[model samples]
Target chain A: MAILITPETKIIVQGITGDFGGRHAKLSLDYGTQVVAGVTPGKGGQFFEYGAHKVPIYNSVADAAKATGATVSVIFVPPPFAADAILECVDAGLDLAVAITEGIPIKDMIRVKRAMTGAKTRLVGPNCPGIVTPGTGKDSFGGCRIGIAPGYIHKKGHVGVVSRSGTLTYEAVFQLTSKNIGQTTCVGIGGDPVNGTNHLDVIKLFNADPETHGIILIGEIGGNAEVEAARWIKANCKKPVAGFIAGATAPAGRRMGHAGAIVGGAEDTAAAKIAVFKECGIEVAATPSDMADALLRAAKAKGVTLT
Target chain B: MNIHEYQAKALFEKFGVAVPKGTTATNPEAFVTALAALPEGPTMVKSQIHAGGRGKGTFTNGFKGGVKFCKTKADALAMAGNMLGQTLVTAQTGPVGRKVQTIYFTVASDIKKEYYLAILLDRATSRPVIVASTEGGMDIETVAHDTPEKLFKVLIDPAYGIADFQIRDLITKLGLAGAEAKNAAKLIRNLYTMFWETDAAMVEVNPLITTPTGEVLALDAKVSFDSNALYRHPEIVALRDLNEEDPKEIEASKYSLSYIALDGNIACLVNGAGLAMSTMDIIQHFGGTPANFLDVGGGASKDQVIAAFKIILGDPNVKGILVNIFGGIMDCNVIATGIVEAVKEVGLKLPLVVRLEGNNVVAGKATLAASGLALVAGDTMADAAQKIVKLVA
Candidate 1:
């Protein structure tokens, strides 16, 4: 019932010859993800085994797509080449592209975004931990463990978890898991300024998922992304949602964590985002623990019973 | 990752963005030599420190006061010598900080037209946004705050490049006419190219000035390079000013950890800065103290984790250690390995409390099972903070 990725989705690994790429590809295969092919220029005709299933490798994304019909492309190219890698995937007509590479130059992403306008292909991240659909066994990137639902602290209910910080997504999930609650899906939208997909984009997907009852959003200080997402959640999302904005106490004009997490001007701050979320009638978590509690109360108020 | 103005201007020049002729002077003698190299008469002297507010600094202000038009090379040398190595306490760096390392000597231009221009990655839109304002030379923070409407911000289309229409609109907003407008538009396009080529995190030209002779030149420049993208930009990597950075932060970067010094009493060792700062805030709220802010970063190894612990413990103000780790790509077991080993090596008598979560939590817990070290493990941040506060109190 999760959006974007599923067990049935065929995956292609771009830059699979690289160290990080090869490692993630092996792990993804180990996790039972249907990794169909690998793409690395000058390394075509190679093969990597995922159990009994032999995975073929191609030189470019276009060749890999033609050979294996891989719908989803997970890019592990270096920062400098990440933009070109994503562009290659888009050209190959991938249904979704998940970029694991961090620190991509903003201008390169700007060019990538320009090329993606009105295109059918959807990009997930240029600096993200990628997406994971728990229990049903689906993950875009390698690190997320299968069947290990950190969001299981919140009892099996309809709450969808969305976050910009990759680690914080796991934090929210861990909190929910501790409470014995499970999420329909947890998304790590990424904190890069020029990341693929966003909080609002994921909210739309979650809103349409019948299995998803409510939502929990974890955001950091920086940008108006949270504000934009809160507006969308208020207008469109019907389910109850809880929000937690990190970096509320961060010093003004300091980049606390992510490059994008800096307090830019007035509009980009945790306090401001929390205010917007509160004004929209969405319950706001004062801290990480508080966020998990808020989600619990939201589900309880909606008459959802714990298992 | 921030380059000096002279270096940034060189990058701007390469991309065909007009820039005033300037050179960096390391010493007072070099300052005089740089001033001699530039075309004579009333050149502006600016102290080059990473921290802003040099114009209002005591040393700079004192040097400027001593100068009566600096009509000769001797006068310039005397002024430069007096200013060099002197501490400049300003509004930016509160009393007694940041010595003037270098001074920038430049040919002053009669600014016929002033426009503010900056290229930054817009996190919300996930694109590079070129922010321009006709109201230039003032602080951008003030402009963004008071009169945001006066600014003309456009998301640069990476594919087609900065569109002709958008550039024209920006020029019009800048109140340029005819040839000046066309030239300004071209400058904007070139600046975009420079911004891309340099892998700049932020490229700002405060007072993108049009000289009296109908030439637009970047009067002041500030460029911050993407530290992560430094792998590809070898030239930028070489330009890193080690003196301008905190030694601890520099040392931590070698191990791929991000650490920032803060004025607090309780030194924190956390996995993420968001969590670290939050931990500090929680400690403060609970009437405990936080001395420094340290984020060991993701995927920390045993040695790096040990190094982080040692670095935090090294701080004199640190009475106790609060290790808050919400492991993800990093395994809790690995962190436990580091913590146990570091505690043995450092042999601290200070109270310690650990809050660990995520991958291999059970394994990590198992490793810490019989370690009789004054260590307490909590499942949550609240519990960990409360426990640490109790121990310290």
Candidate 2:
């Protein structure tokens, strides 16, 4: 049982006819995610083909959900319409909407986020690597993946990982897989300034999961999110948590690819966040390799073995 | 994503928020024309730069103010002339200040009470928030540090918007009255509308003023639109003043590389933004200053990798280079091939440290080794940092 998404979850692709959407759809299918349907406006009654697998395309999320029982929505819509697509998915009552689309405007996301209040649907990212529950072989029944991070790097294990950076998630997971310490779930919450899920949100879910023996959090500069999440960990988190913060050497006020990657204040700096993580009595990881060692140590402390 | 004060004012006007009538002047002649359009008496000459604190900042040529209260048209023209070609070093702008290419000329307002107001995303609430204080003429940061109680914030409900009643706290705290309070509430609502419609990340009206004539005005404007949402507003994109930006950054943007120049000796080139940042951090953690932050992105092409190297090497301050690539969406060999190509094309001669992982690592390392470019190989990110720092030291 994974923390956010599982192998059993069926996904519908939003903007599936576009290049990014279409290509990632193929990748997700190859990774064995249950990508059952696609949404492209006025492209209804058509099919998006990735070899013999022809995923049905719908004009709206409503039609696809009605036909395929796709509980999860994997959005690759352009930034302008991405927020509306997420809102449409939420209104359509999808259990989870993973937005791989980066650069959705903050104000637009603000509206989508507001609409999510008390709503049943959970959102992962508007700019993110998405979530993956990697278990066994590359088959629909063996694993779960929702973002653009390379799928083959992940392996099923005990550590639950959440990160704000997409490629770093793959790096951390690859290191874990190399070391024979797999994961319960790997979630890249995204690098946008305003995103749906955060470190604390994923941590809360991981904390409640019995299968996740330890947790690895990858935070970055800009925003006091890591600090806030560390405070939460210090107070109530029951699981062992290892943390890695990016942007430690990042200059202030530089929007580093991700919108939210700037250092807004002193406390949002990597040094500051690492200090907070230390104060929380958590294992601190500086690099991707450091993350693997820290995570395995945490799991060992939690009475688990990698081999 | 940041716009000039005049550009911000243009946005304010579009959103029904009142502001001082101002026109942008790019030349001394335009400055004279804009000054003549103003009512009378003193006019405000503001240097149009992205960073804040222009009123207190000094010019690089030893002039006192980036902002000037010009009593005559000749004075306004002279001030504009003094600013347009020179750099203004504000507290926000480092020692090497930004060159002023435009000046905003506005009619000075009659101020009764100076207040502070800004609308930005409150990450904690995950909602747009309006922060206000009556102590406005000074820095909001100073306000936050000194009198925390004076600062008040209201999270706008996206569904319902900022209700008139929701602004009651600001009104009460600032001692606003029937008309001023009512008008201020309406102003807040309009600002929220602007924030929503423009896909703005932040809109700050420092020294939001109340005139002796019983009117509220945005005395100064600072607005930043979300770069991700720039597609939605091409007009805003058109307002981009590239002259104010770093040439290296501009070039990097053209190649879709996330590059920022820093004052250091070691240039870093990495794949993912997070990894790039962490690589920079480890360099600093190991007592080495990074020259720049360059992210070649996840699926970078060979050309982009070459361009990234060119940009990093463009800065003569860079004495060494560190290439850390963690291949997931990116293949390690692609980076290695690009590095080899860039070295041959540019006659590269810097102490380089290469750390490669993920997809096709062996081939990437093999490619780098075959190039015979005097590159030191590191097994881990930390090891790479230590090696690069040692070489530079």
Candidate 3:
């Protein structure tokens, strides 16, 4: 079983009328996800036509959820309005909201995060690749595909993968799939400094899931989220976890691509985080290419069968 | 998004955070007029550059310091002459120093005591935090490491804002009483306002000093704004000093490409930030040095690829190129087509290794193969990185 999503998780698209949102909405439908509804404010009575699928549109998240029984939403709204779209999902009391939009202002996110104090809806990424629970069909086709992750690389199985990078997550998933290993779910928590979910939050879910036998945790430099997660894993988790931290060659204070991937202090550097991972009994990947193999080694050491 | 010291001080003044009376001049000829505003007592002349450690920094012309204190305004003027138009290299500026286009002149205050204060987002708490210390005018990192107790942090609740009690606690921590305490409280409030209202990434006041007359002032200001929020603050965007940025980086920004120059020989062009960074790591793992970090971003157009190629080739250190794309929403065929066009337009000479995966990857590989552009294709990221390293070697 997947940690967050499954084939039965019906979902809606927030900006389903825009080019990016519309394109991904069609792709998600094509992947056999339960894409039930669309939300585009003024485009209320319209429908998004994708092959045989014709999803109804609503003016608000609440309306879409009520009419279509959609529990999840994938936001593709622009940066200026992305925060509000997230808030709408929270207000609608949807089960989860996955924001695929990037470049949202930090201040907007700060307020959104504050407003989500005890909300029912779980927010995923504002600058993330979203979540993919691999299907049982050929090329992982029948499972839930939220946001923009390439669905074909996933294989339904026991190992859970979580990361702050999109392509990096794909890299790990591809490696695992190539080795005939499968995953329960692959989550990209995003690379923004103030994203909704983090490495620790996703790890807790993976730890609780009985089907997730082993996990691959990918992180980069910047905040202490990875270290925090590693410490938690050391204290409580018995599952074999393989970790990889990027930005070993990144200079101090210079942001390397990701807004959150800057070397702020000594604790958040690649070396410091890797040291923490080692001390926490995590099998750290020497390079990004070794993520899958590192997990395999960890599982073997723990005698945890991952296949 | 970092602003110069003078620009930060001006911003501080606008936010009611008092600073030393100062004036700036961009040339030696304007030094007389700029220093005329000061009362001719002990004055400080400082080079205007984005990086810190200016006081202890040395100029390329063998000048001793980027910042100097003079007994008279004439001495200040002379020091400004030595700094203006000269390149000042600091610990943070790397080997190639920034040219000091402007010099700041201020009336050096009689210091009664020094304290440190800053306002920035605490990533763990996800709130604004005020870091204060009695031990000022020194490296905060050193203070945090050696004497952790000396540092005082007030995590402000963004919902309720900074409370009066937190400010009072800070004032007591700094051992301030009466007039100085009152001044520090107001300064802290105003600083928070500036930080929130301006959407600042960080606002630091090193050596937040109290004068002999019990007046509190910001002696040094280091402020950076969030680039994503820059659209709302045109005034802050106006303060952007393009001279302080690499020309290639600035050009990359124009085309929505994320590029950071490095000191290696193999340049990498990839899609997505996380993949770009790991691409660098994989290259290094294979005993190769990456010359630059370039993320053409998701959904890169054909023009962006050409623009990215031009920017990468601009660096003379680059000997070969690696293009790694694990496309999700970003189609790999588009990237492959762009690479072909970029190579043809730029008249390629260097060995290029391309690795394409996910979302029409087969078509992407076919596009590269059909181009007849003399490029090598790898099956995976590791294979591609290894191939480029060997070719470049």
Candidate 4:
């Protein structure tokens, strides 16, 4: 019942010959993710061997898909070429592409996003921590984690987590796991000016998943996506959602860490978002440390037990 | 990255967008050279800073506004002198406004109507959008607040480009006729080109003016390019005004470290942008002010870590420093060594707290413990936050 990825999700790693890519490819294979192929131009037929698990290399995504039948893609290409990597995955008609690479020019994403409208592939992040869905019981089903998230932090459970921040997502999962509230899936939509997925898109998926009993939405200043998500949470999602917005004390115009995290105006501030969440029947966590507890209360309201 | 008005005007010209001829002046003393580029009659002595609301802003030397219209060269030069080096205080720029190092001396156009027009990324539609309003002089935020109906938005389909029908609809809505309608349409199209081509996050013309002869000109413009996309456009990068930014921010970019100077006491060093922000928010919540926001990033090297501490210690206001790392793709032992090496190199004068979690936590903790440095170790984010706050408080 996990959202996005699962035990059978065949994976392909883009920019596989690079240092980060090669290392993470090993890690993902070790974690039991179904990594079938690797892609790096001019380095085709190169074998990526780590312990007993060995994957074939292809020069192009189309070749990887044609031979290995890899349905999912995780891109680790550098910033300058990340956009083309994403478009390449889309051209190959991957079911989903998780872009682990950060700093892809927003204009490049501006084109990538428009290109994805009618395409078969659904892009995750150009600058994000990818998606993770822990396998239930002893890591049997390949425990679908696509990106560089610490594998130990996630635990298989009913709560689904979606966020724009990377380490903050880990922080929330840590809190949830500590409280014995495991996550069904966690997705980092990203922190760029232009991103692929949003709170509503993830929430819609989580709501339909029977295993996902609750959801945690982590937000920050600079955009009105949280507000729109709050309204959607009220109207559509029957499952209880707990939310946290960072940069409460952040000064206006200063970009606090993330690219999309600047207070635009009155409507885009943290307080305004908190108010909207509260108004939408969402139990809002005042701080990052309070998110897990707030989610517990929300789940309790919905009669779902954790711990 | 926000470019100055003159820089934006140059970009506008490059995209075939029409604007009033303007010349750039570095200092107020260079008014004679600036005025020489302008036609006779009336000219605007506009202060060049990163912020908006400059037309309504006041200078520290008791100058009325950042912008001034003058009929004579001496009057324009005098107005420019009062603002060139003085700090401006705008509604957007708090009490201490940015210093006006550059002045744009441009010929003023005869305004038949003032309109507000901008092309920006619409997050809802995931497309480039043009937001146009007949009400120009007022801030667009104000227009969105007071009369949202007066504002018109057209989502430009990336596949289709800007359509003639969309332009005609916008022109008809603006009550434009004859050559003015055609001119508005052309400017709208050019703005779209500039927005997508330059990878601009925002292309704002606050008061797009129409002359008596039915010509549309961008009277004022403020352009912000996507920081992520700056690599593709080196010319835009060259236009960056380093004097306008914090020296530490510029230095942080060199090491690929994401650091922002804040007015607080607890200097934070953490891994990941999300965790870094949460650290700041938690620090503030515990009644402790954060001195700065510094993220060494996901895959930080030992040298990058050392450089990060140097940048943090560069700020003398920092009373305490907190090192929080939730290692995922990053190894904890590497972070631990980075901390030890950074402290030894920089000579830690501030009370420091270190919190390391995930991937080789025990080895990381052992490394920090054996270092014999005066560092407060925390087992959790909550623990680290409380300890840093207590030390600073």
Cα error, candidate 4, residue A80 (Å): 2.6
**Regions of model 1 farther than 4 Å from truth:** A15-32, A36-47, A50-69, A136-157, A256-265, A300-307, B59-75, B94-96, B178-183, B272-277, B284-293
Docking class of 2: medium
Candidate 2, residues A1-307, lDDT tens digits: the string is: 7887788889999988998778778878888888999999899999998888989999999999999998999998887788889989988998999998866777777777877889989999867878889957832126887867777777787888899998778778877887877788999898877788888888889888888878889998778878888899899887788899988666666652112221133477778899999999788985666888997777678666654
- For every model shown, what is its TM-score relative to the native structure? 0.89, 0.93, 0.98, 0.95
Write the residue-wise lDDT of candidate 2 on B308-332 in tens digits.
9999999999999999998866789
Per-residue C-alpha lDDT of model 3 across residues A1-307, encoded as one tens digit per residue = 6888999999999999999989988878878899999999999999998888899999999999999899999999999999999999999999999999999988888889999999988999889999999899999899899999888898989999999999899999999999999999999999888888989999999999999999999999889999999999999999999999998887667862211222244568888999999999999999888999999999999999998
DockQ of 3: 0.57
What is the DockQ for all candidates, taken in turn?
0.40, 0.50, 0.57, 0.52
lDDT tens per residue, model 4, A1-35:
88998867899999888998988888788778888
**Candidate 3: which stretches are off by over 4 Å?**
A256-265
Q: What order do candidates take by lDDT, descending? A: 3, 4, 2, 1
Best by lDDT: 3
Chain A TM-score by candidate, in order: 0.88, 0.93, 0.97, 0.94
TM-score of 1: 0.89
Q: What alpha-carbon RMSD in Å does predicted model 4 have with respect to the real structure?
A: 2.5
Summarize candidate 1's per-residue lDDT along B176-282 as a digit string, tens digits.
88778777888899988877777788888887988777888898788887676778778888888888777778888788777776666566788765576677767
Local distance difference test values of all predictions, in order = 0.74, 0.83, 0.91, 0.85
Residue A68 shift from truth in candidate 4, angstroms: 1.7
User: Which lDDT tens digits does candidate 1 get at residues A6-108?
Assistant: 6667889887777777776766666666788888889899887656868888999999998878788888888888899998988999899988777787667
Best candidate according to DockQ: 3
